[model samples]
Target: MSETSKVVLVTGATGGIGSAVCLRLANSGYSLILAARDISKLQAACAALDRPGLPSHRWISVDMSSDASIASFSHELATDGTVLDGVVLMPPQMRPTGDCQPPADMWRQLFQSNFIGPLELLKSAISTMRPDPSQGRGAKIVIISAITSVQALGNYATSNVLRCAWLAQAKTLAFAMGERGIHVNTLSLGGTLTPDYVASIDLRATKAGVTFSERLAEETLNIPLRKYGRPEEVALAVEVLLSPFSDHMTGVNLLHDGGFTRAY
Candidate 1:
């Protein structure tokens, strides 16, 4: 299939990494279905892309924290019947972590957005993808997960647990959909210079009575590469995972950390 005819769905489309991934895919000629919670941010993202002459890629409001919103988004996609060639699932960032455990209600909300909602959308999306040789190239699914999915982080207990669950979910989907020609995989990221990562460092800087840059530099020392990754750098990996280049790879977590994670 031609690039312009292919459709890709991206959740959390307004975020730092997510937006970069969208831009990369747009430049590669894929029609995008941008999904996120805030309508204004979504509009701003679409405007920044500026695809004036060609078919305008769409933006749909989606609250991963709410089942109704996810269902609505899925219903719209199913109704449109746009043959999805790629699906990128980037769950919304979680609240800052602390030493104390959060309330049970908070955990439920976190799981709903980080785990359940995306899974539901995946189910709907699979139905709209090319399933076999007769239907053209197979569809690809990329779930953006954190490095904590493999490693344990005491501070980010909720994320550590939920992201691990998502990894398993992606692997299961990979097997379930492999015969149908859908590639399901997860991209595990380490520290990137995204707004969320920067804000987290800034908070630590404030509490430690140090400059944000200094804190950021100190944090980078833990990474073997001695720097936080740029959003575009991570987006490149997303491109690879979604492209035909990764046709042989599936049911795996491709780590994009700058060597911060030591585990193999």
Candidate 2:
């Protein structure tokens, strides 16, 4: 662990992929700024982390779906004299509710939370990342996208659209942010076996009148790896995007789908 403790914030910190990133960065010696709307869950997650020889974490109540909440959280970070070193944006785990037709509100919330909120966080924290153009050190922004964005999902149209938009947004922001040494990129993922996945399976089971495992198994079959992903595996992808190894990289979208997306 390095003594130079830089602040790294992770949104949706209670989820599978997000929590894995949270733990990975914490173990790597970064002081974390964890955010999620649920205070109890956030606190419990913080307590559960075994920092051992790593830096402590900071938590803020943030609802990415609400612009007001995101703004307040950013403001609080700004006031606390903590500048950002890295950011990992994770969207909420959303599933289709039988209509197979995307709801307008679902699209709205997903777009805001998945794309807009993170963009706002980056914009608000830009000054902190790029203090002086002379000194090339700047913050890094990493987004968690889905492999399904490239491959169409039968019922998850909201994700199909919102995730694509988010990747585009990341590219745009990357080009704009690169000059100051800030790095921006995305990790498009495959199936992850998170608690959220379990919840979605329950819904699928209820809808199909089947057991949860049966529903989950059906969903997992599409993944080329023939299994759901572990959160730590996704975290490793995030780590590479965040590290100095990727300092030259920006405006790039990397896939971590275990060959699920066959088309390059």
Candidate 3:
């Protein structure tokens, strides 16, 4: 983190929405610092990002589900010695494991993946960002939550229960850091056209006593927009919130669902 470099650390950079956010942020000229447990995928993403005229960036291997990994990442960030401009946190989802339906252990694992892990990552990263506005480095931390947060859906008890916790933490971080001039927000996304979501739908449907077609039809009927959102569509909101365009906002949970969550 050169003092001159506007650093943006994006965790879970190998995931579907995470990857899209990375691409959009890179295009916006922030020197990217990407992290994921999958070094191979990170390498591929990093290689793809080495544009002819883009800012220099780096990728690292770190496990979001483990405190040691988060601690290591935090130290690594501090060594860079520059206050970050923004952080985009997305965690690898822990799906219902084994024989379809979630076992007790599976439920805990899923919660850890969706809500616990990202909160840990956010707290760790926030500690490294310079907190003084006098230094000209106010930061933003954006958490990628989901449309499921507002509604109870299917057999996704893990994601459903944990999403509440995630939103609570977003609200907490917003208040906690508001005095320091840092902005915190959450982006509740609709179903995006990502391989991971396709995989999640099939897996959850099989586990929830629903046929794939039934599940698919149910989702199609719900979205007022009548279609799944593209990953870029969700990523666009993330890029805007983290950019200077949204400097005045904080603690907002902007919903990007295709009008699917009708709790409005």
Candidate 4:
């Protein structure tokens, strides 16, 4: 199958990393289905990816935290007979501060957004993804997670737990779905200088009585690369995973952490 004929659904499509992935895939000739909670932002994201002569992209409003919303979205995809060639699952990046041990409700919320909802969507998407005999592989599923999954982050206890669960689930699915030709993998990222991360740096700087540049430097001190990742760089990684380059890879958690994770 040609890249132009492939359809990729990117959840959280309007976010920094998500938007970058969408643009990269679009430029590589893949049709995109941009999914997010906000209709206006989804429209804007879709519009931004629109090229003059390329295949037009589509958008859908989906809140990954809501079970009803996920069910509805899944039904819509099935009913519409949407054949997905790839799915990029970018769950909500919720960094809840304050308790090291959060409440049960907090854990539930985190699990739903980070694990349960994405799992359901992947199940639904897998049904729509038929392996192309000509290509000898089925669809690709890329779960976007944080480096905190492998390394703990202060005040992000819930994320620390759930992201690990997400990675385990991806590995399990990769094994379970290998026979079906569906490649399941994950991208665990480090401090990427997205708008969100920049704002976070600004807040940390204020609290620490330092400038943004100083705080940013402190954040990258432990990383061997001594720099945070760029959204465009992440997009390129997503593209490679989705392309034929990853046909032999599965059940792998590829870390884009700039050498932040030292454990073997």
Candidate 5:
């Protein structure tokens, strides 16, 4: 990558939404550092994003749930001397508890994976970022959250708590980092048809003794758009937030929910 090219580190880079974001950013001329737990998947994602004329992209293995892994990754990031420009943080993988009162151990695990670990990683990422307003160089941080963060989902108790924590943290960081020319924002998503989500809908359909299309139609009834979002649509929204178009935006929680979020 050229010295002047912007470098963004995208966590969960191999997931549906993450890979789409990588492609969008790469096409827009940003070099990427793809971070994920699986090396093979990371390699595949990096290869998919690489093209003849685009800036090179690389991958690193880091388990966001492990403190040791996060520390090691942070050390490597700080010493690599890469002028980190931005970060797109995808929520950690989690299973639905299906009840509000989960075990204490589950609470602890979710907190570490969703709240504490991401906070530590962001601290390290911010340390490596060099933002200068006068030079037209600034940093962006986009935290990808779920609609559970904004509304209550009976089966996603842990996510409801943790994602709300993420929103608060993003808002706090926006105030804390704004003076340093870093824009921190959150994107709350709803019912995106990712592979995992599709599987979830399939499970629901089987449980309800209905066809997939029937279950899916029921799922979209509450959404004003009457459809789930596409991963590429998410990528477009992320591109705007990470670009100069959102230079003046910070502490903003943008909802990409097909108008499913009814809160004022």
Candidate 6:
């Protein structure tokens, strides 16, 4: 890799899609700082992305569900003099998938994880992206929301609502932070073949007393592509937003659902 490689921070980096994005960015020659709630899992992800002769990736334990943790992590980054070129924000991976209304506590926690915590992190560290606006360099932010944000999911009410709110938050931030040279956007995705999606499908199958394949087929049947997206495919879209290709694009919600979303 070149010495001029960019530094990118990827939150929730141990999750299926997050890890995929980390690997893809690493392979593309970007230095990464991986963050998650679990150091063990985050370390494992870093190890997986390690190339013997390349600059090794770094891991930080960050509990995005907690305000203190997010503040502490942001403070650490801010004071360390590390300037981030890009950020990939993956909201909490463990999401409620049933149709039943979640309890008040569940709703609060989901909002914290999916909305408040991330917004706080950005508030604390966004300035570090462009310490001097005159430098003619801006930072990029890609928020990973679900296509459920745009097209409501019958079973995933909490995710649908919370993630949609997050998309709005990103759009709002884009305008607020534009003058600072920070590009903020949201990527609303549909049925990607991540482990979480597969597990959710399996649970639905068990609940319906149908074979997993049957449930899977039913889920994809309405999708125009009749298939789930690969993690790398989504990662590539993230890569695009992080690169110069999206310099002119901000506050936009790009859907990468392989025709799964019914909404425009």
Q: Best candidate, TM-score-wise?
A: 5
> Residue 46 CA error for candidate 1 (Å)?
1.3
Error (Å) of candidate 6 at residue 113 is 2.0
lDDT of each: 0.84, 0.78, 0.77, 0.87, 0.89, 0.83
The predictions' CA RMSDs to the true structure, in order, are 2.1, 3.0, 3.9, 1.9, 1.3, 2.3
Clashes of each: 0, 0, 0, 0, 0, 0
Worst 10 residues of 3 by lDDT: 93-102
Stretches of model 6 off by over 4 angstroms after superposition:
97-101, 131-136, 203-212
| Model 2 lDDT tens row, 54-140 | 777868988877899988988898887777788887776666544556668866776787777767876776656643446657678
Model 5 TM-score (2 dp): 0.96
Error of 2 at 206 (Å): 9.4
The candidate, 2 or 6, that scores higher on TM-score is 6
Model 5 lDDT tens row, 1-264: 666678999998899899889999999999999998999999888888888877999887888789999999998887878778999998676677787888899788888887888888888988999899887778999999988878888878888888888988999999988989999999998878889889989999999999999999998999999999999999999999999988999999999999998889
Rank order by TM-score, top first?
A: 5, 4, 1, 6, 2, 3
**Clashing residue pairs for model 5:** none
Model 4 residue pairs with clashes = none
What is the number of residue pairs that collide in model 4?
0
User: Which TM-score value belongs to model 3?
Assistant: 0.84
> Which consecutive 10 residues in model 2 have the weakest lDDT in total?
127-136
Error (Å) of candidate 5 at residue 48 is 1.7
* Top lDDT prediction, candidate number: 5
Q: Which ten-residue region of model 6 has the weakest summed lDDT?
A: 124-133
lDDT of 6 by residue, 1-264 (tens): 457778888987888899889989999888899988888898788888988656667877888789889878988888788778888988776455685677889888877887888777766657668624577677899999888778777778888788778877888888888888889989988778888778878999999999999998888898898888989899999999998798788999998887877665
TM accuracy, model 1: 0.92
Off by over 4 Å in 1: 1-4, 52-55, 99-101, 134-136
Looking at model 1, the pairs that clash are none
Q: Give the C-alpha miss distance for residue 246 in model 3, angstroms.
A: 2.4
Candidate 1 versus truth, CA RMSD in Å, comes to: 2.1
